[model samples]
Target chain A: MGTGFLDAFAQEYKQLLDSELRLLVERLDAPSIIKESMIYSLEAGGKRIRPLLLFATLDAFGIDPKNGLPAAAAIEMIHTYSLIHDDLPSMDNDDLRRGKPTNHKVFGDAVAILAGDALLTYSFEVISTLPNEFASADTKLKLVIEMARAAGTEGMVGGQVADMEGEGKKLSLEELDYIHIHKTGKLLKFCVVAGAIMAEASQSQLDHLSAFAHHLGLAFQIQDDILDLTGNQQVIGKPVGSDTANDKSTYPQLLSLEGARAALSNQINQAKEFLKKTGLNTNLLREITDLVASRDH
Target chain B: MGTGFLDAFAQEYKQLLDSELRLLVERLDAPSIIKESMIYSLEAGGKRIRPLLLFATLDAFGIDPKNGLPAAAAIEMIHTYSLIHDDLPSMDNDDLRRGKPTNHKVFGDAVAILAGDALLTYSFEVISTLPNEFASADTKLKLVIEMARAAGTEGMVGGQVADMEGEGKKLSLEELDYIHIHKTGKLLKFCVVAGAIMAEASQSQLDHLSAFAHHLGLAFQIQDDILDLTGNQQVIGKPVGSDTANDKSTYPQLLSLEGARAALSNQINQAKEFLKKTGLNTNLLREITDLVASRDH
Candidate 1:
């Protein structure tokens, strides 16, 4: 439960995730602009938290986590795509992401849009093409189907629509939860489930991991809401108050800053509880929960 | 085969495909706007050519064509998503499609974009979840991989970029070929290959189907270019000369109208010849080729 250990575990996955992503792009043999735009957003460097989640969960099962490398990279691609599309002028329209130019800002909206589209397609391709020896075709197909569902209309994209339509409206906590769960929760949950499935964990273990991820995802969003309201723009990599500026609702607005903080803590503790119930050596997962709970940026 | 026979064959698949698409959207249990936008595009009625190609190819092999319904619908969704994105303001900026307002014009840019994303993701979900009786997990995985390749940057999106960048430039036939092959050809080719794979065709059969599809796709594009120049706007569901209006290079623009016409005929013939090589009962596929070569609209 030390920063030293958490940093080391996370650092390993980040390097693997980053190198794999770059190689994935390099091997595409696509036109220069499309590849450049994709690589730019991917290599821009986020926290690599999603991959860390997948790797950590796989690690807890004592599986050779590298076997899940493609799937982890695929999840990151999906995350990167959501970010690119979310930053489009028609959507969040931010000029900066990760302290660099957003995809559309540098590549133009058309290329940026296509770049996101390409990555989305590539994600499925990556997972589907993983070696069938360790990862059976059935397992890969399940991963692809689950990832698609999470990323599809009733999940991420649907949540996006709900979020957009809710702009300028005061949303009830229930409505906000719907958006938060679908928007970010589904994919985070997928990261945890992906690890379990790849490790061929039992259904009981999967249920536990899924519950752990659900709370982790909610905590992640609540913390995001808190940071948007109170954190430093330099550290957070974007201006605070964007939600308020966009006339959208957030946990801090609906639940109050103190209420949001309490909710975050509750969710983090719940996540840890679920992890503990799995009866697996999840020390790394526990540290991640702690990192998510108390991180400043 | 008689036109009556072709129409009946096509009519059966269209109804099945249309109903399945509607049911799929209905079952998504998504928010209203996303559902509304997706159904609007899915039901807009664009000949369902991709699905028809899939069904026709599946039929030729004596495989139960209905078994491929999910995949056929998936292909159509990918095609629809491309059209939705292609017509975006930053892209072709078309206001009309199939004699109706474009998705963006109907639902606003954000919903249209997300609608497209939803459909793209849903396509894979549908294919991956196909009944185990119809397709082995290995077959499903291959379908997912090929679809991704066809839809990703190196295929459709890459073709679109090459197209957008090629605008207003004087392009040779070789350059035009590259764009058409990737943009329209890749997906079309996938339809053929998908059916073959589902039927577990031999390698020689696959090669023949691939070749057939390549010619059919090129012929399809040439005919589209011709229609852009000479067809009625109302019949074609958009203004004639939109391609030229956008300053895009086309077969007719680079090869003279007569030369383009001849090329179209040649390709259609080649497609038919390849089908003959497959030694499958491909009467329906041949008819589809003729439809491609001679369709005025």
Candidate 2:
């Protein structure tokens, strides 16, 4: 299952994301330092989970994944921008992300920050550039609105603010939930919803997909928290226990390791249940679920 | 005439920008340090040129100034993000902006970068959230698209990349023009176009407005370059000659001071001619042109 699923998924979806990213980055005029900085981080290796979920969600609806490629790429751009800014000296102050010096460390802080800004704004341009493909104008507009919301104040940014403030202080479980939901869950939900929007999924399908994404996101964050405590830095490609060093509130800090583990299991189960209602090719989704639950890092 | 125009412009537009900014900042969820950092830089005193253009453009079209408030505020948000990121230690490394410690200095780099990111994303959210009074969904979407273009790789960011690359190097006049047009002209053009969009102007009116904005933007940037060389630090609220210190290419660097003055005069004249074709209220626009040409800083 791992080989088959990974092979098929990587073959199709990863290629689509890579092609889209290449096209997008190639559009940046050649040899401009900030553009180079943007391209470097954007092409940096990651699992492409967000873009894959977007493609998979479209596939589940029997829509051609190609139809959602722009949106998929756009979301990835937004995600990359978030990661770039998150690693800035003023933020996470990290030297490495994905086994390379962080964008700021490599490109200088100004260029890194501007590149992230450029990427974030370009995501919208990518979405807007979709040429009458998949979904009505209304749907496309709504997708843009949703993407903005997910990436903006009420979603990831809001959660980041909460996370930054909640550091070095204990947070109630509810507040922690709020932070995670906005920070991670919102964009994850956008991946699903944006995919559904591209596919023109029924409202019912959207609702289920949203729930699925929410649960999956919770599980994903919990797993990350757990991995930060237990995973090797070489494996994770980032320093472990940095969260602890920052005194950041995490699932483990709030729920204890066992409790966090249980929460992850519960969320994974809920995600699986939600996926079941979609009645689509659930193999990859299910595998990802199991992967989320058991992954060491 | 100069004093009265400045006073009236300040009274009418500054108040609106201030109120809109306050309301926008107040909408952030409380107790978030990142949000506070965002608000700090956003509220820090500056000339508010972008928002002024937005408002003035709307007024020129006889649209209620209040109707353009959201877009005005959103433009300012984008501008604020640029300033915050530009002042980062890795970027321009400026400790001060607008006579205050830069956002990174005041809030730390991490929170400041995040705050800038948040504000950049939030600008779109604010645009998306504009009440229905602004225009139809299609028009709003167009505004979003225009803004995305201006802020993204093809516009402001592209120009920034070129500017960064051109540092300490002699650039041709054409290259300097391209850099300034992208870095400053694009957003300034967006401010005007956004107002015209909100007012639902005719295609011909939009054409004229576009022309007006394009030249006005060039004029504005030229004036900025001149001010950097000749203006007082106290009046300009930033260190004069920093551009020269950084060996950054500018219009004046490519053109002799006399040549730079000629270009500014030509652009302002073109801007006035474009406004003449529009047949809109020319009072504010005329004063703006004059102010751009004559300002010491």
Q: Which candidate is the best by TM-score?
A: 1
Q: Write the per-residue lDDT of candidate 1 for residues B177-283, one digit (tens) a residue.
A: 99999999999999999999999999999999999999999999999999999998878877899888878888998889999999998998899889999999998
Shift in Å, residue B293, candidate 1 = 1.1
Task: Encode model 2's per-residue lDDT on B1-107: one tens digit a residue.
Answer: 46587558767877878788878878776445766787788789577777777777888877777888788888998888888877877777889776788998888
Identify the candidate with maximal lDDT.
1
* Candidate number with greatest DockQ: 1
* TM-score of each model's chain B: 0.97, 0.95
Error of 2 at A129 (Å): 2.1
TM-score, one value per model: 0.98, 0.92
Error of 2 at B123 (Å): 0.7
In candidate 2 chain A, where is summed lDDT lowest over 10 consecutive residues?
A1-10
lDDT at position B91, candidate 2:
70
Please provide, for model 1 over A183-256, each residue's C-alpha lDDT reduced to its tens digit, 9 standing for 90 to 100. 99999899999999888899999999999999999999999999999999888876889778878799999999
